[model samples]
Target: MTAPHTGGCRCGAVRFEASAEPHHISYCHCGDCRRASGAPVSAFVGFMADQIALDGKSLKTFENGPVTRSFCGVCGSPIAYVDERLADQIYFMLGAMDMPAYFRPTLHAHVREQLPFLHMPDDLPRHLKTSVPRPSSSNPDGTQS
Candidate 1:
């Protein structure tokens, strides 16, 4: 595995260190993700929550359906997305990483909601929703496959 990954908010108010390597890196085209990052799509890397140590009293969260998004209260930089159903993992926005290029997304999720004006230049698999193995619970992002 590579060296420990470290990152923080834009204002340096929030910081985190992850020992374990991430899995299921993805480009999410879901509306919630777009809204959260103010981008047509958002790239994220998922790691076990226990593998990370987060700091910053300014970190705040917004629970959206089954996911809670954490960010820096001062800079409002989107930090991570905690999925309630997947209690063991946390999804950190790829762009927030100090070494964002280290993580390479392998798939696209929520493609059904992708905007017509947006397009990606990759041949990775695209799923209507999550590509991560998930319980058959109703998908909070949209319809289940």
Candidate 2:
């Protein structure tokens, strides 16, 4: 694996580099992840927090309990998600990576919450929910006022 992999927000306002390879990569289908990314599924690469370096100070964070999601303040592009319970790691938003192809999702999480219109065409393992409980949601995605 490469010593350093680089990526940034869509508008390039928030840049970062990860020195270590990810511990795991997967597609998160939880409602919180979907809403945060504005996508059907959110792909992420998890790594030790100490291995990543943020190039700028343009990161704005939103918290849901112990989990904090970071995004580019200028462009609203999701950057990373940190679960305080898992303090040693950071989940980098895969779409924000300069070389997304380098990271392949190995499984699917929160499969029960996946949108009806979405489908997983691959044979990756699917979990009814993630190993850790996601923020529970009684409302549908994008429907809350």
Candidate 3:
């Protein structure tokens, strides 16, 4: 998907605009993500934090370990996820986007935690854990060096 993507919460209490193409896009089958989103799997569209602008008075955040997730307090719509390991990027929940069909996930993460009943017959690359690499000065692109 291209730039200027827009989206909001179910109640329209929170909204966001991303000014650039996503840096990463993937489907996560981790238990945490499943539980948080109340779905068997969750998809995210990642972008540099600076490339997105959020507007909401009902936005709330929850921090767990090195990750912080944000949602709309009014409707409990999951918004974004930020991991300290990838401090420069923010992953927005694909379901919260206005045109979710436009964003195609390139990979599957936490496959080991996927539900046995969920059968996604896709050829996308699968990872036992997260596919995102920790970013550092030597790995500015968040890729393994």
Candidate 4:
């Protein structure tokens, strides 16, 4: 079997491994993501929840409505984001990945909420809202295929 993708919090208080290749990758410019990551934009790698194993005592979670975000309780490094609608999948913060450079975002989400000063000069497809379709389970990539 291939080696699992690995990552951890800044202080080494939280660590995780994903056994499967990511099914989706994208950049989110929504205000919620920005506030959660404390960055102008947040990139994520999405994997089936069952494929991820988080091993750490400092993992904590915050819930707002249907969204629950996980972070390192010790270093406060953002970890993963999950939405009730997409409960089967977990979106891990790209910045927390051990090899963030290996994952390239395929699209940009919530473009309408993107900060005016943040200019990404890429030809990636941009969506005004979440790229993932709601009430969806099998197609996290937001593609009809």
Candidate 5:
């Protein structure tokens, strides 16, 4: 867990505040991630859903495989991901945070599809195509956007 958090999308329509810490912070570099963020990887921060307080308007979402992706309809900025089985937590976009600087990616998952030029530390485990991430690359790695 980190510090208290606050964030929203590109559009101001959807917003929220969390007076809790974050867990399972990492960057995912997979085909789905590339498509969602149009980058080598997608940086995400996970949080317990009950701690969040939404404001203004509701968000729209699409099913991207196992993740329920939420985003602001007005601005189209990706909001969060709700696990189908565990609705208590949400994976939110790191870029959507009001104070995003505090977070840094620990490792890059789904390394099988990482862009050739996208340089990241290789000391971390590189999963081939599929893996249920544990916190660290070793025994088990384990969260966020």
Candidate 6:
């Protein structure tokens, strides 16, 4: 299903679109995610990075040891959470996208930092940390079929 949604950086200079459907959707409460988004839990929809059209400029990435966080240089919006091992897939902040409320945590990562008031439901897999899978394609760029 094609959900024609669009969003941009805080400065509104950078924008993106998921012409097709999304890949992974989740709510992450990790420390890195909190710091990156300045929220208790950050929502994201995974996508083939190259699949999402970036109309303005590219992102400015910050390497925090094992992972890197990227954002629009013009808007400085929290754009994605990227693991070096899974460079093939990128998680675009769900809250950043202009779509209906689609908050479903497929898996909870970083239980240590999860809000104490919030208890995870057994329906979804819970993990201390998660490593999202790369798309099936083997292209150097993050474009999917």
| lDDT (tens digit, per residue) of candidate 4 on 1-145 | 3449999899998999999999999999999999999999999999999999989888999999879999999989999989998869999999999999999999999899999999999999998888887674345765522
Native RMSD of candidate 1 (Å): 3.0
- The segments of candidate 5 whose C-alpha lies over 4 angstroms from its true place after superposition are 1-3, 56-58, 122-125, 129-145
Q: Provide the overall lDDT of each model, using Cα atoms, as 2-decimal numbers.
A: 0.88, 0.86, 0.91, 0.91, 0.73, 0.70
lDDT of 3: 0.91
Decoy 1 TM-score against native: 0.91
TM-score of each: 0.91, 0.88, 0.91, 0.90, 0.78, 0.73
Give me candidate 4's TM-score against the actual structure.
0.90
lDDT tens readout by residue for model 2, 1-145:
5869899998988999999888989999999998999998899999898898987688899999878999999999999999876758889999999999999999998898989999779999988777444335323652221
* Tens digits of per-residue lDDT for model 3, 31-76: 9999889999999999999998999999999999888999999999
Order of candidate numbers by lDDT, starting with the best: 3, 4, 1, 2, 5, 6
Clashing pairs in 3: none
Clash-forming residue pairs, model 1: none
Residue 101 alpha-carbon offset, candidate 5, angstroms = 1.3
RMSD, one per candidate, in order: 3.0, 6.3, 3.4, 3.8, 5.1, 6.6
Who is ahead in TM-score, 2 or 6?
2
Q: Which structure is stronger by TM-score: 4 or 6?
A: 4
The C-alpha stretches of model 3 lying farther than 4 A from their native spots are: 135-145
Q: Model 2 off-target regions past 4 Å?
A: 132-145
RMSD of 5: 5.1
Better of 2 and 5 by TM-score: 2
Which lDDT tens digits does candidate 6 get at residues 1-145? 3666687676776677876677777767788788888888777787776677767566788989757877888767887766666766667787677663653547666666798887656676755555354345335664322
